[model samples]
Target chain A: MAKPLILVTNDDGITAPGVRTLIHIMKKIGDVIVVAPDSPQSGMGHAITLDSTLYAEKLTIDEESEGIVEYSCSGTPADCVKLALQELMERKPDICVSGINHGSNSSINVIYSGTMSAAIEAGIEGIPAIGFSLCDYKWEADFSQAKEYVQTIVEQALQHGIPKGTVLNVNIPKLTKDELKGIKVCRQARANWKEKFDKRKNPMGKDYYWLTGEFELLDQGEDTDEWALANGYISVVPTQFDLTAHHAVQELNSWNF
Target chain B: MAKPLILVTNDDGITAPGVRTLIHIMKKIGDVIVVAPDSPQSGMGHAITLDSTLYAEKLTIDEESEGIVEYSCSGTPADCVKLALQELMERKPDICVSGINHGSNSSINVIYSGTMSAAIEAGIEGIPAIGFSLCDYKWEADFSQAKEYVQTIVEQALQHGIPKGTVLNVNIPKLTKDELKGIKVCRQARANWKEKFDKRKNPMGKDYYWLTGEFELLDQGEDTDEWALANGYISVVPTQFDLTAHHAVQELNSWNF
Candidate 1:
């Protein structure tokens, strides 16, 4: 039987250690193809390059790889997935995995995440997808501890299949292999960034602002991803792209329109 | 009684007719403050400018307006909202209204809409918010037909708050006011873009591509936003930022973790 075809991509540029680790792991499971951004796209949520042209080029990233190929695109994460599916790949990938991102995309951060947006784009195109993120946000963060769990989740997703119109947001807690607990399928915690803009002036004495914020978790529910991560467990939240608030439809219907 | 303080914004830039029309109508309803992008930010969904310094400057768009003020920001729509709320506004807005966008943001387009993302950002910040868009994509599309309806919706939303954690995605069909069949509360139709990349060669003899697509509606439900728009009615889909697929949690939990 042919090995399952796996598409690998990320928001943190092609050379980031996080995606390199993800590609390394996916190679052991199937034929791998990597199409990612040429530069970092950390907070580019679902953005597509509409006003500008896109450039993608084939390149070699690994020396010892046999069935692995890579391409880097000059666009957002969502753009990379769209380009790969429509122009690059000959057949639909069995699954697409994004990230092992340098920072967490566990809660409300998902809305601003380039990482999850790639996975969600694949999900929109009828491909099973997952986005993996680590709790640490360092250039040199250790990714070895996540290798076993990452392989396991991808293996399970390939076997069981993710539900239609949904993708997985898997966040690994920052912990050693022995200190790590198991995994938990959980809901997205209700949380937000309390945005505080640091106002400053440039050399010309003109006003400018730097967006800085603190993540504030509002949901204390044990079933939430926040809780699972805090308790040393990896969190897997089934994220969907259908934005309709289904429960509010009835109440809205009651409004005189 | 003091008028409601309405925060107005859009992805089509501060000078676009769509947002200018929105500001004109909103001024009749309240003391309006406009904080919008300096240039078009189409398709920049929920994106924020974290890696770059942001610049915002107060400007006068309408010389005759007394209580209306505007600011142009060098950031995404989501960043504009965050700046308005954190560093600009003296108090929380009574409500936030985004767009009067030059194109539709119905169905799956919501995932890639900067208009709706601005509204969603406000919703995440605990403010009642709504995003309005027309089916017409032309820069000079007539917004007059939407004025009365917009006023009514805003009045109603201010009177009866939107449900917590949800923002309204309102799309107006391209029809005369008399030809309209009123508004419909609906679910987001299942749909996706059938992407077709127009590959071309650049001046330097290098390959480049232009992203283009056609919307394919997969859902035949009569209660969907697509159905409402095609039938000459405005579609209002209550959109939420919490992306968790709650119904799928149980099924996913069945997997061995």
Candidate 2:
């Protein structure tokens, strides 16, 4: 039997250690193809390059590595997935995976995440997809501790198949393999960033602002992603692209229009 | 009685006729504050300017207008809302209304809409919010026909607070007042773009591609936004930001992790 085709991409650019680790692990499971952004697109959300031209080029990242195809695109994470699926790939991929991102995308952060956006884009195209991230947000953060658990989740997803209209947002707690707890399928924690603008003046003496924020978790539910991460467990939240608030539709219908 | 404070914004820039129309109508309803992008930011999704500094300046678009203050920001639509709530507004706004957008944001397009993203951002910030869009994409699309309906919806929303964790996505068909059947509160239609990359060679001999698509509606449900629009009715879909697929959690839990 032919090995399952796996498409790999990330928001942290092609050379990031996080995605490099993800590619290495995916190679153990299937034929791997990597199409990712040429630069960091950390908070790009689901943005597509509509007003500009997109350029994608084949790149040989690791000369010694065999049976791996890679390309980098001048666009957002979502754009990379769209370009790959609609133009690059000859056959539909068995599964698409995005990230081992440098930071967490467990709760409200998912709304602004380029990593999850790529996975969600694949899900929109009816592909089984997962986005993996670590709790740490450092350039040199270790991804080794996540390798075994990442393999486990990917293997399980391949076996059982992801639910329709949904994709997995897997955020691993930054801990040693021995210190890590098991995986927990959870809901997104109700949380938000308490935004604070760090005001500063540019060289021209004009006031400018830098967006900084503190994550404020509003839910203490044990079944939430935040709670699971705090308890040393990896959190897998099944994220969906259907933004309709179905419960609110009935009430809205009562309004006089 | 103190009038409701309505925060107005759009992705079509501050000078666009769509937003100008929105401001004109909103001024009749409440104290209006406009915080919109300085230039067109269509298809920006939920992006925020993290790697760059943000600048906002007070602008005098209509100096003769009373009870209205406007500012233009060098950021995405979501960033404008964040700045308004965090830095600009003296108090929490009673409600936020985005767009009078020059195009549609129904169905799957909501995921890629800067107009809806602003409304969703305000919702995340615990404010009642709505985003209005016209089906016509032309710059000079007539917004006069939408005035009465826009007023009705805003008045209704102000009277009955929006549902928690949700915002309103309102799309108007490009029709005269007499031609519009009515308004319909409905679910987002299941649909997707059939993407086609128009590959071309640049002047410098580099291969580039332009992303284009055709909307393909997969659902024939009469209770969907698409149906409402097709029948000459305005469509209102209650949009939410919590992307968790709650129903899929149980099934995913059954997987071996």
Candidate 3:
């Protein structure tokens, strides 16, 4: 029997405590390869480096894990996954896991998430993938609490396999292990950011704006990811890349084109 | 009757002929407001500006349209929409139309499309939206050929109202009006890019790579966007933001997490 080869990547850069904790857990499970951005790419969705050159460097991040390979990429999270699958890895990973991100990627945040984007990228390439996120967003946020839950989800994904044409977006509530309620497989909640621009003037007296927002949950559904997270449960939403609204196809066909 | 306020935007930057053509057509249909990126942002996907200050300035791209308001943003397509809705536009638009893009955003390409991202952003903001793209990628591609179809689709989308939870992903084949078959409502084809990294040594003797890929269509579905485009018809896929694979939620719940 061979250990499953796991590819690890994230949006919080290679040195973030979130990803570092993720790497530690993945090591205990299988062979690990870390190909992640060299800098933070927090809101970088599924962006690929189309107009620029990409640079990836082999780095020795974990000295103790003699078999673990790592690469630092000068691109977005999606780019890292592409570079890893096409150039860095000797073979396709058994599963690609992104994040343990410093903040949540549940609900509408998934649309702007670099963490989920990496996992989705792997899913597009026919690999089973999962994106893990902690509800806390601080640079020094404690990622240690979610380690046990993270390992269990990955193990279960490998055993039962993720549903085809989708990847898991697992967001753990920021709570102590004892306080955590457990895992909940849920649908993405309908919600969006109620954006507020913090207007400010630069030294040159030119007005510039900082994009900030508050999460506004629009759905009251109990089965939604937001509801699960609010109840102290780790939420797993099966996210898809095929953006088609299939239900609308029939109605659209009735329209006069 | 008050004119339908149509918000116009694209990934091809503010001055591209594709958007310019789109603006020309939109002016006839409604009170137009243009908020797009200052430079080409193709393949930027659903990215938003988080770590940087956003700068947007009023611009006069079309002088004759005295009532039309336009702003050029120093950010991604998604950011442009957020700025328009949050800061620039005085009122909520009746509809948001993105692109008249220089290239196709059908099938798997939608996963990496800044054009569709803008439309999807507007949809997330509770506006009826549509993203239009031409199959041609050349800068000077004849956007004029698709003008009639573009106008018709926008008009239809405005009247029909995009399905709840979805926007329209419209792709036009690069054909003269006479050659083009009628529009077809279709599903996104199951497809992905088979990535190839163009590795090279930079002038600094550092290894760099250019990401390239060939579109691999894995689906033989006749009702897919690819099929319609191949047959010289315009393709309209109702695109959703909820990303949740609803069918898979039940199966994932069966996992022992």
Task: Put down candidate 1 lDDT per residue, A91-182, tens digits, no spaces.
Answer: 99999999989999999999999999999999999999999999999989999997999999999999899988899999999999998999
What DockQ values do the models have? 0.89, 0.89, 0.89
Tally clashes: model 2. 0
Query: Tens digits of per-residue lDDT for model 1 on B140-216?
Result: 89999989889988988988889888999999999998999899999999999999999999999999999999999
Model 2 chain B: weakest 10-residue lDDT segment is B59-68
What lDDT tens digits, residue by residue, belong to model 2 across residues B179-254? 9999999999999899999999999999999999999999999999999999999999999999999999999979
True contacts kept of each: 0.88, 0.88, 0.90
Please report the candidate that would top lDDT against the real structure.
Answer: 1
RMSD of 3: 1.1
Candidate 1: which pairs clash?
none
lDDT, ranked from best to worst: 1, 2, 3
Question: Which regions of candidate 2 fall more than 4 Å away from where they truly are?
Answer: B63-67
**Residue-by-residue lDDT tens digits, candidate 3, A65-91:** 456788999999999999999998999
| TM-score of every prediction relative to native | 0.99, 0.99, 0.98
